[model samples]
Target: MTFSKPYATREALEQTIAHHAWLNEHAGSLRLPAIRTVRADGIDFASIEGRHARFTDAPAVATVLGRAHAAAWKGDLHRALLTTAHPLAHGHELPDFVSPRIAALRRHRAAGLVNAHQMTAAQSLLAASPATPVAFYKDTNLRNVLITADGPVMVDLGDLTLAPFGYDLAKLLVTLAMTYGPLPPATFTTSLACYNQPLLGAGLPPVTIGRFLGHAELHHLLTLPYLGKSGYRHPWPTVRPRPEDLT
Candidate 1:
């Protein structure tokens, strides 16, 4: 199987390793494995053996991934709240391709299209939300998670960078939609239920959580254009966008 381009920095590798270490250290609380970095080809790699979490024959692997992702997002959110003096201080850079809401609306009108325009507009809304705090993930997807007997272990951390809090959830949702087809409404609701509880517990306002989800969704939709062009294969099935799905 092909892997995406290797993670470029030692710092990225270390951050991922640290996340695993944290998970392991709090295994009783988090129930994830402690993974260590292994050096090879001048790049750092890590592994969580197959024996750790078993989803091989599980029909609900997707659901498992969904919950794991929700849990992880909560963990990250909690950490962001506790350790950082300024919640929004986490440095998440907006990608250059993201169009502002006005521009997106214009693009929508000019093209008479909806999906792209709507996606862009949503992104703009996310950017404008003051309550949304950003955090970084090296790689945020189900593929990077290993299912061992112990639990799920997040493995890759190469592309880690801070972004809006719910960005990972959006990415995961989009991936699931793409991979498994348009998500059942139940999936989205269930995942959100898991995701929202923690944010509320962390004293985050509901609107902030909504903004984060919007950002995540927008980020996923906008990034769809460039997915397969990179060495990384698209994780979900590609479908022509319906006119309604567009802006």
Candidate 2:
């Protein structure tokens, strides 16, 4: 099968295997399925056996996102709170190919088609947030999540980072919004309520709830190029002049 961009590297595959094993050992409470590491050319490949859910409808996507948000909130408040704090290091920045794309965004911003302030705000939140939960999965897009007879199983670990609790939620929400337009306010509100209730039940502070919403919005804006016509259908042209070249 043809895989998406940012295909798993040997080192990344090893790290994922190690992480899965560590989680199994330390957090036996999580009922995750077994995963084996495949080494080829001294590189590791991910191997998991499970079905994946196809998110064709908004409600279905919302359900998965909501459940993930709630679970993240319940499982780790500190990390959730920090979702607005810690930013990934430059070397670990998203999509593993962001320099050029960010440059494109800069040009778009200069044209007043995109908002610079909003993008900056999102970056600031990510930088300020505390390190994410150890078990936090960053990329929660449809391509990464798989549905099995039992439940959803995430496979891609490329975007996994130690930055914030709801980083994954924000990522998923942003993708959903770009693909389907704005989410229903009521649905988001309900999801937030459900997310906060468990934390309240556990006597944790619910401060990050607002930050999560803000980040979700910002993520949508920053990732706009990857969705809609700019994405899969119309890729950025190769050999395009630099932003300075246009001047």
Candidate 3:
């Protein structure tokens, strides 16, 4: 993405370029794209080298999340990030993203924009889940992941941070649903189980589709104001799987 006026300052552009360089130094081990940064005539541009396909399907999403999570949990890489204490590491900030005020949700609900039942369920899920923070790639949305012949590669490495165990996966799952509607109930269950195996292996907490969907719903509600009423459409169908069906 080009870093230009009305979007980012010159200092911000330079910082991004430096961060890309730092990430590239560990590209081989981390499976990240090599970014080539350029500046010309007062405009700065950053381009990822090599041809890669965007991961679009549910199975692809599961596979990539498993691999990325495994990599992030590796002893040496995990230690390196923690030791550096990078400013990008958003400590205890994931809750803020999913936990919007009741008054705000009420406003949306009153406008017929958010479902009252869904909002209550989401709040319950967040309350039940553990609040302890863990190191995570806070921005694992599909746009940042690409598929090459070898495997998936993550770009936009700047958002590495600390959040609850499942926040990253939840973010991607929600983004997937937003882009291409919700997955079938069986499909969602299978995918969650697939990714959870690695987390279990790493001694990290397994993600529940129920809790993540709760997060997804709240996130969707939060974005509506920014997206504007005219530009928004609900991603899930009316015939959704019952709450009991989610794990």
Candidate 4:
């Protein structure tokens, strides 16, 4: 996937190019496609070939996530990933994207699209998870991950950032809920149990895991409006949670 650097100066684009390169710099289960080139003369380009992700598919994404999380903890790649990702233009920001979900919520709130309770719920979520950074692909929905023959690879690391582990997990869960339906109770529970295995093994407090999941769920709600602003394209819809839904 290719994107034009929103900024005119080379400063932002230069940093983003580094983020692209860092994905390939690592040697591990979570490695992504090598960036062929990033053209900054006019429009930016970070291209790669042989994506061929059909083989890895959905389950492969989970395998990569489980492994990445575990490997991040075990080999201490977590710090390495964070160190490499920190120089990125957008790495340090909260919500991880240029258009952050919380900022989106504030806009909707001003327009009276959503009530304060939703904001309160979202705030509570943010308070729960630690603000620690990690090597995370901010966009992990099914479409972004490519199931390649070499291994399950993640594409579109453009949004890679140093953010809460739960944020990445929550974004994936939110995408699944939007694409499928309400979070599958049994499946969601099981998946978190699995995702948190590494975090727990790494010595994080047990309650922190629940906080990350809750924080991420609220992040989904916050992102809905921004998704709508983008024309509610496929996998995006112009909607927000009802009051009862928040409770």
List candidate 4 segments past 4 Å from native.
1-12, 25-27, 41-59, 70-101, 128-137, 200-209, 226-247
Sort by TM-score, best first. Answer: 4, 3, 2, 1
Model 2 has how many clashing residue pairs? 13
- Decide which is better by lDDT, 2 or 3: 3
Report how far residue 204 has shifted in candidate 3, in Å. Answer: 1.5
Clashing pairs in 3: none
Which candidate's lDDT is highest?
3
lDDT against the true structure, each candidate: 0.44, 0.45, 0.52, 0.51
Residue 183 of model 1: what lDDT? 46
Top candidate on TM-score is: 4
lDDT of 1 by residue, 94-133 (tens): 1222233335445554665446557456646545333344
- Backbone clashes for every candidate come to 16, 13, 0, 2
Find the 10 residues in a row with the least total lDDT in model 2.
232-241
Count of clashing pairs, candidate 1: 16
lDDT of 1: 0.44
lDDT of 2 at 168: 56
lDDT of 4: 0.51
* TM-score list, all predictions: 0.53, 0.56, 0.60, 0.64
> Which sections of candidate 1 miss by over 4 Å?
1-46, 50-123, 128-131, 207-213, 226-247
lDDT per residue for candidate 3 within 1-247, as digits (tens), equals 5433222455544454555554444322446544434453233334444332322454555655665555555532443322134342222121232333456777877877778786676565445223343444446665665666665566664444434455666666555555545556666677677767767776667777766666556556645554423322444443234667774
lDDT of 2 at 17: 53
